[model samples]
Target chain A: MTASKPISLKDEGLEQKKRSTPMGDALRQFRRNKMAVVAFFIITFFIFMAVTASLWSNISFLDAPKGFKARHTINPAGLDRVDPYAEPGHCARDGLDQGKAWCALLTEEQRARFPNSCRVEIPDPNQRQWCYILGSDGGGKDWMTQTVYGAQVSLAVAFVGSSVSLLLGLVYGMVSGFYGGRIDNVMMRFVDFLYGIPGLVIIIIMQVYFREISSKYEDSSGIVGFIVEINKDLGGLFFLFIALGLLSWIGTARLARGQVLSYREKEFVEAARAVGARDRRIIFVHLLPNIIGPLLVAETLAIPGYIFAEAFLSYIGLGVQPGTPSWGEMISRAGQEGGFYSNRHMIYVPSAALVMLTLAFNFFGDGLRDALDPRLRGR
Target chain B: MTNVAKSEKVMTAPAKKKDYGDPIVSVRGLKKHFPIKSGLIFQRETAAVKAVDGLDFDIFRGETLGLVGESGCGKSTTGRTILQLHRATSGTVNFEGTELTTLKGNSLREMRRKMQIIFQDPYASLNPRMSISRIISEPLVVHGIGSERDRQKRVEELLERVGLNPFFANRYPHEFSGGQRQRIGVARALALEPSFIVCDEPISALDVSIQAQVVNLLQDLQRDMGLTYLFIAHDLSMVRHICDRVAVMYLGKIVEMAESEELYTNPLHPYTQALLSAVPVPDPDVEENRQRIILKGDLPSPANPPVGCNFNTRCPVAIDVCFDWDPELIEVLPGHWVACHRVT
Candidate 1:
């Protein structure tokens, strides 16, 4: 160090590529994990299926439009959608043979209600594939289409609910932990109390109250009215979102506070203070990046939980509008309509979708938690 | 808030160099005691750790004042207290004309820019989340010293001056070696062009070879910039090599202070005698035959230091008077000072 060394960067013989950042390091590690990679693809495939559900839905015999312009947009009322009440193996979802087999188990009145077993088979193979692809629920809704639409609902619940949790929890916990003393004591006690309450029960109570309020004010004109309108359009999903989101932030706050407690005493934080940086700078700059890794992995892993919570609420008949086609709604209505008596495929289709999604989220999240730190990745 | 902005502008402007040899930082009976609080909710102080019991020293402008002591002897605490990193418990630390203890808010931070510290453990000192360039220019950014382009240019200059390649600025702290990371810490400290720096055992964490390189770097930096330093360390040989004047401390009090050569050849206090003797001499004959003065007993707890003179519990030549009265630092020679009743 007595004399300045004259070696240039190019002469050092290191790689000329862009330097790896923490995110980049985490990404490099994520790509190396086989389960995570597979889970990532599967999740994206679910998203693609959800986003393009209305396409390729129409069968040939229904006289569905064949033009590109007709198929590009959503077919809400066209032959693209099956008779949601059509029996599982009837012309609603499966071929003539399965339809006859399923029709044998139904009473005469039930047989008359879903007329799919009485119709002739359509000769088009592509159209036929759309029928038996996942069969249908008690509503005669195509199971594959319902599964795709359920993905959309799950994604909505996950993102909106998690955002609420992350925003509220990060700020609450950071403030509580950073200014820890009486304030931390008082605030953390409140969070602990919130944790003790059954989150599902509280959300159910909230959902019941929300339903009454939204229906009573459905005709008014204001923010509440506006929300009621969205609720009607989304088929009661809006209330479920609010109920689930309001209760999910407690765990995130606890995790964030714990992380902040551990990081507040690190030397880098003291070094930042030594540089004359203000408290806000210390919290956001020096402190946040170090703690955000685990928090992110937790949030990702918790998405499946949010999805399941919404599913549970819907299953108990306290979530969504009657015909919303959410997976839980499908399962609940199938059982009520007695599609499970002999035609068991009604329950099997939606259950398989639910299990696959939660498993995918868990595998991806587990891999992410391990790979978030750059040092850990290197080792 | 505006005051901070104004101070930032003033600090970044051209620095006016000052003459050396006059006292730059004057400490008078400075003390720091950390409270040990009990209870979870309504906390109470049970005891206090007297890290720096009563310190009095003068750091001359552009000179390195070596502070040597055994582990847990408050050498690091003294440096931190002087920098206002840990507020002093009592007395005064007057930097130039301003009394440091009374400073608050923007003024305190403004005063902080005039002084900086190079911390030990290069691995822990730097922020791993930031790039090298961001770490170096953090003080500049905090003070709002320059435009982004200007800060980048200044960072590059500082890197080169600290003997690191400027192009490595984009890399993170984890990519660098311990020695290079120490150099980066130096660059960060030098970013503000502070008049005084507390080098808090900057070389203790490095290898023996790396320690020499870093010490030489610090010396070169001080010479070129005319910076004053309070170099705190336990390495007696290294302290002797780099310090113009040396102060030996025991149990949070200076036992002897004098020119490095004088303290080495003509030590007055028994504590200083034991410390210097512990440093291995280079010559084989001298190393084998040199008289060794090994003191007894472990260091007394800072929470409850022994009454009267702190060294009485371990001093080899203890007298009855030594247990009842604490000695004060007083000049016995032209420039040499000793804090022992035996010294004439």
Candidate 2:
């Protein structure tokens, strides 16, 4: 028995030696998943782009007309002066002249109404460079630059909104779960009450109400004046953060409460208590670490939901103000007059970005869930 | 060992009831009932699970008092209640002449430093995320006992004391086997230099081979530290091996308690007798010849126990009064206490 025991023990020792620490094991697992790795890189690339949006926007690919050059112009309504419904790649081929292939396509009455629609003589043809790589929107802003900048707003809202929810949820849930009895019942019921209310409708109403209040206090002095300045700077996106944060936390709160409720009864927690560890220590040091695996996964998964909600709100025109570059706002504009047919890149670029971001977050969250699960450890 | 047993028997002899010194911990009429709440919207009181219903016992200083019982007989609840881990619904636990039930906040915590518990499951007792050093040093950190360097030195010393390598301090609980983790649990429990430790089935979760090692370590610790232990377990042989006195519990009440050798040699209570009979003898001839008294029916639910004696429902020698009147623990022999109408 002793000889066999040593052999089996030696095998176990070898196995143990091969296995890394839990955190290291999780990282290794995450690296092993090819799709998750790809998603991680894609997310990182977008974050990089979002952070360096200003640098990308300043590149003078499309120069304003020089001396004796016919400048590309937009109508008062922000329509293209040459061809309002010009397809992507049209500007590069036509050089803003519009007479070559564009004029023949227009009706006689349309041509008569705007005689320079297709044929505008320009001395410096080189000045009319189509620098908008992903093409331009109806407002003629560079699509690529707007898309890059929009990433900043989307990611910021998602990150900040999720963080707010996570904080509130962790505190509220811990209090409810740890205390239990009447306090738990009352607090959980309040959570249920919040869950009963439709979050989207409340967010929209809050946005409108806060926007009106912000505008009224626009000139107020002191701290309120400072807040007003910030509000003006952020416009509706500021309120969007508040609304999203307030509305999205219920799920996290419920999850945290449930996790804590189960984990608080574990013998380790009881052991901590037996050692005369205070409630704060028990909750933060003992209970929190055990429940963090599930909470982390839940938080990761919740981020994509917030991002999607932001896009959804913005798509419906209840989100960020008209002037701000947001993915949803871009997608909304792409559904406008001749947008789908002519400037399809405007519709697809932002839409593709939004889909890719949500998918990346979800895939990464899945990897995290699998890697951090204690039951699946040493697999 | 024989001389100590003879002296303990003489001190606890029935004729001299007051000879035993003041108990280190005396629990009087301890009851811990968990309330059951039902209904979704407006929860109402449904029923209470009387886990530990009116237990009374005294644990002398520097001695191992074994609490043996069938599963769900509330041995664990009694231990936890004594430690004040679970608040008693009603009763008093006097630890070294201080009423523990009345103590609260800092006083209760200060009391807790001197009294610690080793849980049943080593796997669940130690935090998986914490290194052995952190787990052991936590009690010291909580009470602000020493500086960082002192705590580190103490942790390493504790690791060595618990029969584990000092270098294993940096490893997490999951890295160790069941026996190793139990040692870590012991190390953590001993960090405060607690005067009393409740070994709540400490070796039950370990392999049969490793169980003796843990028990020996615990016995050595008790001798070395002069620690009092309330050793709760269902394993009769092990209790007989280490405990000075043994208490047999049935449905949250102690049916019999006596010196370990006396109780095993001559069990007075019928339930105690039956319990002892269940233990298989090592000698095949004696095992085959011995009569095993198998009790009828499962343990009655503690939430709604039988009206009179809890064991009366299944007592082999129950009298007419056994069904109507509750039996009280009374001395029937020197150093032997039994709760049964027939025994008296």
Candidate 3:
């Protein structure tokens, strides 16, 4: 029976020859979770959209220069091009020009009120001349282009903000937890002080302060001027990254500090110390890797919070400067002068994107939590 | 063949006489007090936990010295302090004719290469994220000992030496059982070819069947390498099997010290006798009829140990002087030491 079992097991073992590493196991676990996989794909799609946003927006009909005539058949007058809010599928009315009888259902007064609304003329021969796929916003800009471009800003903020926080938090927490004495006490208390302050308030103050500094040196030609130039190119989003990163690190720092506190006592760290590993090596090589599982999960979950915070700040006019395309800024525009009722797509488009992004991050983060959990490894 | 014979002769002879010419490491009045603090904003030191208080011992060349005590008796702290893993609050650790406690920076790190420690928990001792090869090679990498290829070859050789399959080098610690992980740990400790190692309860966390295998491996390694060990454990039987001499601790102080055979056969200190009495004999008749000395009351907190002697609060043979004056560790017999006034 044992001989027969060995023969069967050998065949099975050959099929399972791929060695299972910690990372491989985690990836396998992540693949098994259906929702997390879907969320991961969604996030990947958004990332793709964010990276290629300029390409998408450049060709968009809604991305036409201000006052540029469409010169299309939809209306020789190009009335739709000048309108602040064009309804989606408005081009369906142009089919009336093909002599569709449905146009006759329109009341005589309605026909008089919108004489050229349903007219069809030859579109511009130039391929570049196109219309909004999701319709135009209150500013006569393509909603599709704005959305794609807006995604770039939000995603960048989340990625850069979270990375900055992770770096700061990892260093701060490692130093605090590893040194562990009066230095740890002082450092943690400082983190506690940071925790007490409202993140948005600090961000607003920093944004306003940096904005003044940037403007003051805008024209001066020196290192400060060079910084101003870079700041201008990034717009006020640079300040947003700084503010979010600086304030957001407290949570990650606390989590990292707690992890380090426990990990510093682990025998591996002692073993490392016993082997004459320097403090830097002990913290980075031995301690950090052990604590990384939880740190990664914490970082993943924190990214969505940064995205939401960016959107919230932008909505209140403290985020990206005016004229830069942002989801929150678009939502703010949508709420103005009853644009919400008239052009609901403008509001709904960015809102849905924001909601989906945050939800995707949350689901993906949850999957990562399960995948990276040490207790589940080797199974 | 002559070298092998000479080493064989060295191994059979009593470890105390042949290889114990001079102490490799000497610790004098070692103290490690951790401050307990209170108050949030303006913290105040409320009290100090004397984890290790006024310990003195010497580890000779190529001899295994057992440190036996119950949990929280500061045996682990003593081992760690001797290695300079934890800085002593006061006193000196003299290793290889240099005062280790006084050494700093590169000097201390240099000294560390000569000493190593095997941890109590094998699961926690090996980095879970690292492959066995990486864990074994980390010390070499830190010390800049060899080229990458050389390190890899050494790692493979070490894995084989520790009785693990050389192919297992690529596997993570989680894939191994407790015993295998411990072997990896031993390989790591041996990587630098250290003269001394603190086996901090190395086999306590292993299965009974695997415990003997690990101990035998250590013994074999010590024989091959001429390694000295401070074997810290609470398992008296296992300690007796491996250690040449043993030091018994209570609270934060050593209560007794002697040759393993003498200490077990004729324990003089009240605490040592009580501890030895608790070790169950294997024979059915002896196990059933052994006179167990159950010490009354729990171990007093090290933060507020009894003023006279740490063991006074729980000493079964306590006297008035035992409560008022601490007894020093004195040589009661040649090659035997005890720390109780009542013994005299």
lDDT (Cα, 0-100) at B16 in candidate 2:
31
Flag the better candidate by lDDT, 1 or 2.
2
Lowest-sum lDDT 10-residue window in model 2 chain A: A61-70
Residue-level lDDT of model 3, residues A1-379, one tens digit each, is 1111112323334335567688898999999889999999999999998777767865655332211111122232344344557665433222323322333566777656556544435363233245567777765567777787788888989899889988899888988888888889899999988889987788889888887888798899998888767766775677788788878888888888899999888899889888888888987788888787898898999888899888888888878877777888878878883556777888888899999999999999999998999787546
Candidate 1: stretches off by over 4 Å: A1-3, A7-18, A53-132, A208-234, A334-341, B1-20, B282-297, B341-344
Residue-wise lDDT of candidate 3 within B1-344, one digit each (tens)? 34223322332333433346577887777899988998866789999999998777778898999999999989999989888888999977889999988788888889888999998899989888888889999999999999999999999888878877676678778777798788889989999999999999999999998898889889988988899999999999999999999999988888888889988998999999999899988899989999999999998889998988678888877889988987876666766667788996
The parts of candidate 2 lying over 4 Å away from their true place are: A1-21, A60-130, A211-229, B1-22, B38-46
lDDT of 2 by residue, B1-344 (tens): 34223334443444333344557998777889988889876889899998887766778888889999999999999999988889999878889988999889999999998899998898888888888889999999999999999999999888778877776777778888998888888889999888999999999999999898888889888888999999999999999999989999999888998889989998989999999999989999999899999999889888889988889889898888999978877767877778788878
- Residue pairs whose backbone atoms clash in candidate 1: A84-A139, A84-A140, A84-A141, A85-A139, A85-A140, A86-A140, A93-A131
lDDT per model, in order?
A: 0.79, 0.80, 0.80
Q: Better model by TM-score, 2 or 3?
A: 2
Off by over 4 Å in 3: A1-17, A64-84, A92-131, A205-232, A337-340, B1-20, B38-46
Q: After superposition, how far is residue B123 of candidate 3 from its true place, in Å?
A: 0.8
- Count clashing residue pairs per candidate: 7, 2, 4
Q: What is the lDDT of residue B148 in candidate 2?
A: 92
DockQ each: 0.43, 0.34, 0.34
Local lDDT at A150 for model 2: 81
What's the lDDT for residue A232 in model 3? Answer: 67
